[model samples]
Target: MLGAGSWGTALAIQFARAGRATVLWGRNRAQVEALARERRNCRYLPNAGFPAGLTVTAALTDALDGVEDVLVVVPSHAFRQTLAAVAATGVALKGLAWATKGFELETGLLPHQVVEDVLSGDVPTGVLAGPTFAAEVAAGLPSAMTIASARADYARRLAESITTDTFRAYTSTDLIGVEVGAATKNVLAIGAGISDGLGFGANTRIALLTRGLAEMTRLGLALGARRDTFMGLAGMGDLVLTCTDDQSRNRRFGLALARGQRAEHALRDIGQVVEGYYGARSVHQVASRLNVGMPIVEQINRVLYEHVSPHDAVAALMRRPVMAELV
Candidate 1:
């Protein structure tokens, strides 16, 4: 694992419990030392003990030592840099995958694109994503996720490596669609949180997500993604789980903002990377470049960055000219 946040720690725990030798690397040395000494990430995923097979390290080389299949679990912004660091180590990676979800900050490149641009080597790669909460997964609750790669065999192998009695994995070849779904959902999840925070009822929240899915499909098709991928775990499952649930950092970020907290303060309070907060910018840039219509995303971007109030955004959305649902 390349990132030591809750999601990374949770996945590291799962890998260790599955009897794989897993090393979790964090950027902070003191924090890594504490986690190493305590055998659990008290700051992020507390109350979840680390398995015996897991090791916490501050050295990137130590984490990459004797690594067979490496899973990078960093945030989207750090995805390329983490891979570059791995490349700098000159280790020959066999099977590589990332659990990061979002577009590059300015370039709007997906995780796969970052891999291609950074690695430029014949390393089989995949993306692991789905509707999962780190706390729940750490507690050994039943969870299912999708592992997608251009190489079907590599995806299957990664799926098998992490799947257990409590956790299940499915494989897919639609990397474009899977990544599109994964990135787009975070943007919509922020809108969902804004709606819920403003005291909008379930009817409004459901409508927001329903239309959000449609907007996501339009953007995905523009990028040549398969339509069915949006209906699968990465799409509908993740969208619903993120937009409706409070466990989502992006959604919680939205909630805090709706309750009158500044973006900086909300992020500081959350103490984790709010991908949706950053996704608002990247997704809007990509959508505009692709000429895709995404009203919800646009409004959320305004609310988050332009200092527009949630109520005003909602009114702006309601005031738009009526159109057919399919459009």
Candidate 2:
């Protein structure tokens, strides 16, 4: 594991509990030392502790050494950098994957794009995503996620490796749809949070979620993704989970904003990476470039960056000219 964040730590614990030796690495030396000494990540995943076969390390090489599968769970902004480091180690990796969800800021590249830009094509690659929270997964509660790879064998291999009694894994070949859903869902989650915070009622919230799925589908189609993938775990399932739960940092950030907190202060209070907050601009950019009309995403970009009020953003959505729902 190459992140050591909440999700990374949780997955590391799961892997170790499955009796596989797991090494977790983070760039922060102090935090790494603390994790190694205390056998717990006090900052991100305080409730979770290291299993017998799990170890934490600061050195990237140590984590990469003799590993069959490398999972990068870093923030989307740091995805390229972390993968580059992995490549620089010159390890002959059997497979690589990420749970990271968002578009690379300037480049608007997905996790797979970042991987290809940094490493050789020979490396088997995939993405793991769905409606999952780190705390529940760490607690060994039942959770399911979709693993996608262009390589069918790669997807099956990872799914087989990670499945446990409490965790289930599904497989998909629609990597593009999975990634599109993962990245776009966070932004919709923020919109959901804002509406809920404003006491807009459950009716309004459901409407936003339904329409958000449509926008996600449109963009996915434009990018050559299977529409059915949006209806699967990585799409509707992930969107519903993130939008309805406060456990999502992106949704929490939106709640803070609806409470009238400045975006920066709201983010500071969350004290974690809110993928939607960072990805809104990039998502908007990609939507515009692709000529896909993501009205909700556009409105979210304005609310997040242009100082538009949440109320006004919601109003704009309500005011848009009616069109066929299937469109």
Candidate 3:
């Protein structure tokens, strides 16, 4: 693991519980020392206990030493630098998996794309994504996820290695589809949260979710991903969980936005980079470049960065020219 955040810690704990020698590499040496000594991540996931087989280290080389499979769980913005750091260590990675679920703001490349770009020249890489809360997963609650790679065999191997009775992993060869679904849903979840925060009823929320799925499908199809993948666990399952659950940081950010908080203020109060905030801008940029129609995502980007009020965004969406639902 290359991060010590909540999601990274949860995955390390999970792999450790499965009897794997899991080493978590954190950026902060003091935090790593505290987690190693106390057997807990006091900052992000305080309720969860670190498994016996799990170890924490601040030294990236120590964590990368003799590690066959590397899981990069860093924030999307820091992914390129982290990968470069790993490359500088001159460690040969056998198989790689990324759990990050956002696009690179600089390049608009998806997480898996960033992995492939950073670890170029025939490196086997995969992505894990779905409807999972880090806290619940760390606490050993049941959850499901999709592991996708261009190679079916590699995907299956990763799935089998990570899957347990409580944690189910499904394998897919549609890496693009899986990644697109995962990244795009975060943007929509913010819209859903805004609705909830504004006291919109279930009728409006359900409508937004359904439309949001359609927009995601359009974007995915434009990106050459299979439409059905957007209807699967990595897509619909993630969308439902992030949009409806209060635990979602993206949704919480949207709630703050709806409650008249600025995006920066909400993020500061939440104390985490809501990937959806950056994801909205990235998706909007991609949609513009690809000439794809995504009104909801556009509204989100406008509200987030263009200074468009959330009320005006909603009203503008409602006032758009009506079209057939099947379109």
Candidate 4:
């Protein structure tokens, strides 16, 4: 595990309990030391107690030492820097996987793209993603996820290694679809939050969510992703969960925005990175470059970065010329 946040800690606990030796690394030396002493990540994952096989470390090399598989669990922004640091260590690993779900804000690259550019070796890489909350996984509740890679064998192996009776992982070869869906859903969740915050009822929320899926699918197809992939766990499952679930940071951040909070203030109040704020920019860039029509994403970018009022955004969306529903 290459992060010590709530999601990473929860995964470390699960893998360790599954009889794998897991070492969790955090950039914060003080927090790593505290976790080592307390045997629990009290700050991020207070209820998720660490198992005996789990260890905490500040040294990137130590975390990579003798490990067969390396799971990078850092936030999307820190992913490249962390991977570059690990590459500096020159550790040999059989496989690499990431649980992070957004593109790099600077380069607008997906997690795999960052890994490809930074890491020297041709390590088999995969992504583990779905509609799962760290708290639920930590509580050992039943959850299913999707593991996707360019290599089918790698996807299968990763799924087998990570899946538990309570935690199921399905495999897919549609890496692009998985990644694009994972990235865009966060932005849509923010829109959902704004709607909810404005006291819009379930009907409005459902319409936003359904249209959001269509917008995501359009972008995905433009990028050469399989159309059916958008209907799977990484797409529809993730979209619905993030949009409806109150635990979602992106949705809550949107709620804060609708309630008259600025983007920076809402993020501070959430006490976590609202990935949608960053993803909106990246997706907007990609959509523009590809000539893809994503009206929701466009409005989200304006509301988030351009300081457009949420009400104005909604009004503009409603005022746009009518088109065929199938478009």
Predictions in order: lDDT: 0.91, 0.92, 0.89, 0.89
List model 3 lDDT by residue over 1-327, tens digit each. Answer: 989999999999888877788999999999999998889999989999988888889999999999878998988889899999999988888888889887788898988777767776677889989899999999889998999999999988878877777898998888888888888888998999999999988998999999999988888888889888888899899999999999999999999988998888899999976899999999999889999999999999999988998889999999999899966
Superposed model 3: Cα runs more than 4 Å off: none
True lDDT of residue 168, candidate 1: 92
Error of 1 at 105 (Å): 1.4
lDDT at position 208, candidate 2: 88
Clashing pairs in 1: none
lDDT of 4 at 153: 98
> What are the per-model numbers of colliding residue pairs?
0, 0, 0, 0
Q: Which candidate leads in lDDT?
A: 2
Over the stretch 209-309, how does candidate 1's per-residue lDDT look in tens digits? 89999988998899888999999999999999999899998899889888888899999998888898899899899999999999999999999889888
Clashing pairs in 2: none
Q: TM-score of model 4 relative to the true fold? A: 0.97
TM-score of each: 0.98, 0.98, 0.98, 0.97
RMSD of each: 1.1, 0.9, 1.0, 1.2
Worst 10 residues of 2 by lDDT: 11-20
